[model samples]
Target: MKHYYGVKVANKIARVMVSSPERSGGQNQYIETPTIEKPSDERSAKLVDLILENITDTYTLESVAEYCMMSVRSFSRNFKSSNAISFNAWLINVRLNYSLELLESTSLTVSEISERAGFHSEQIYRKHFIKKYDIPPKAWQKIFKSPNHN
Candidate 1:
């Protein structure tokens, strides 16, 4: 009887572990780390800082290139070389990470979160979030929200 109970408990534990998204190789695989390292060159470093500071604002490749005082083609090449990711890809990762933080920390609606996260529309935000998380924003919030301390 003791051995049977132990086996049953082990089976339950295995099921729980396998069902977890982290263990199942799910959405986490797509979400990149949000940190941006300073580039070796002063201009690229400045660009990285500017993007980090203005993550909640809309920006275009042209605008970013101008801000960095480089031609669009030059900026794109330099940025990709320094960051190992395309500028747009990095921007999307940053915005999605910010949205995830807001969702976990606040009770804001999805539209409000989308706006604050720099997405042009809630639909766009939802699309990206679903793509990266394998779940909708509300569902993610429900799963990860902090426990009430009260």
Candidate 2:
């Protein structure tokens, strides 16, 4: 069974691939089992869940580490091992995803959405959004609303 985790810290799904032996053997005559790491243990997983639930709040490595009762160094290493991205990168993607959700579902303006999404400014949001998606928020909205319009 394949499990998909919406790793909030990374703002991406961590998919655990479980392929049949036949397929794996066909793909590679000599196959190596890929190693996968889970972001947090049971205790840390709970902390991660809490942080994800309160993503709208101000969050930092120190804050989350304190919440998990771990040192910054240990937390940072574990977080990277599990999520495969730095904390800041994950947070930005999360905020951007949140902003996109708001843009698609709400009538809020860019500034308002940026503020609510914890983005520093509208300009920053636009820059990153365009960089990631190759389209501005406004254009994305139009395209989402009218799928056939091109």
Provide the overall lDDT of each model, using Cα atoms, as 2-decimal numbers: 0.73, 0.62
For candidate 2, list the clashing residue pairs, or say none.
Answer: none
The segments of candidate 2 whose C-alpha lies over 4 angstroms from its true place after superposition are 1-38, 146-150
Once model 2 is optimally superposed onto the true structure by TM-score, how far is the C-alpha of residue 10 displaced, in angstroms?
Answer: 20
Over 47-146, each residue of candidate 1 has an lDDT whose tens digit, in order, gives 7777678777778999989988999999999989988789998888788878876776678899999999899999999999998778899887665654
State the weakest 10-residue window (summed lDDT) of model 2. Answer: 4-13
| Per-model tally of clashing residue pairs | 0, 0
- Assess candidate 2 and give its lDDT: 0.62
lDDT of 2 by residue, 4-85 (tens): 2211211221223343222332242111112223354775677656655666677888987787788999888877777777
My TM-score estimates for the predictions, one after another, are: 0.75, 0.64
Model 1 Cα RMSD, 1 decimal: 9.0
